[model samples]
Target: MASMFRAASVAFFCILSIAVADAQPIKPSASTQGFHSRARLIGGGQQGEHWLAGIEITLDQGFKTYWRTPGDSGLPPRFDWSGSENVASTEIRWPAPKRHEDAAGVAYVYGKQAVIPVLVKPKDPTKPIRLVLALEYGVCKDICIPANADLTLDLSGADSERKAIEAALAKVPLLQKLGAQADLSILSIAPVAGDKPAFTVTIQAPPGTKPALFPEGPENWFFSASHPAEGDRFTVTIEEKPKDVSGPVPLHLTLVAGDKAVETEVSLDENGKPR
Candidate 1:
């Protein structure tokens, strides 16, 4: 009877130790320095089948980094996870970007500090995940400079940074259907005859909301940065396009009003009528 009790006590203590180890916070990797910028990896332990992670970037004052789709000028960030172990796939969730204009052109970017959340899926849920990242990105002030970073982390369990990662995730634009009746919505898009293709986009937003629009299209398609017009209207002009292009153009429009943003897709013909 005494032997049985001792065995049970040992098993309980081992299980408790494992639990505590899993709950301990995972430390972030050291920062990889770049020109006027630095980058590193921070993570929130496993949520379910995937781990919540973030790429934290700090930029020098007056410097900025480009979004996944950099407007007319800078290059978008490229993340390579091929060196990772026990990883199945990873998705980088981008928060809505602010539009910046300069003598070069209009560009969408993140200023000062940016935390980009990533969802990492592992091949084996029960085992630890070794995350390796080779990040290639660009930063700009008066001129643009290419930057690179190599970072790695071992995610054995949960980390204290989960809440911060969640906060960044919240800033990612909620995908919405075009013309949805929401607090901030795209009401209409009409074609404007111009030297090049152009459209007048009208949005319905609250009185206190200061709205901005960013349009994205396929390769070889470029649009003039949108600016506020009379009332809730904004005009988007086509700056460049393929010579063989014809018919309706499919565009992904990101509407940002204050701290909230929504992305929607619309197909517009030469008449600006939605098809």
Candidate 2:
């Protein structure tokens, strides 16, 4: 009986070691001559309702990553979280993007190392959460490289790493403010020609202010190359819907003046125009 008990203890120890090793944090890696990416869970215990996760992308010395709008030359980042359990929803808050122009054209994006913050809410407060993200993005140098990565993060309610997560969450407020203070009165949206359903938006930026407009919803309804025209006013052609699209479509705009950012929401008019 004594020998049997000792053997059982040894086996348990080995299993515990394997489990701990499997839970180690993931490191960034590169597949091609492009960008390297890493993801990790940050805060878990401070707030019982939500946790923070950070995804960082380090572009190779000369390569660049695409923005939410990848312009005409790159592919936008794609994320999938079908395997996540105990997660109510994941919210990705992006930092303000900059405008980059080369021989191809002017593109808006974040270069170098960009830290994207994600908020994860768990359905059960007592259970541990597993988040699996399948991400695909394009990195451009002289040529563009399409890359994919699988990122996993285990969230524990009692983890000590929560402190770092909370710090990252602090930077998100600036981005949130950028999405909340756009000057909507400068934009005039109206139905356009063609029966296929479309609209034209003329944006008037304040003198010396170059603003870019980003639509918050109905992702399929707008054109991909809606660049904000510079000068006293700008105009962008957007594809409208035959009728109001299902669900709620909140027209959130992001206005950037140099390094300053502001956001505003535009409500739909009675005629389906962006008011």
Best by lDDT: 1
**Candidate lDDT (C-alpha), each:** 0.85, 0.59
Whole-model lDDT, candidate 2?
0.59
**What TM-score would each prediction reach against the true structure?**
0.84, 0.61
Give the Å error, residue 127, model 2: 1.5
Worst 10 contiguous positions by lDDT, candidate 2: 172-181
Q: Write the per-residue lDDT of candidate 2 for residues 128-221, one digit (tens) a residue.
A: 8877777788777666678777766776656565555454454332333212224423345566565443455555444566656544445555
Per-residue lDDT of model 1, residues 118-212, tens digit only: 99999988777888898898899988899988889887676878988998888898888867898888887887787877888888777787787
Per-candidate clashes come to 1, 7
Clashing pairs in 2: 43-162, 43-165, 180-263, 181-263, 182-263, 182-264, 198-240
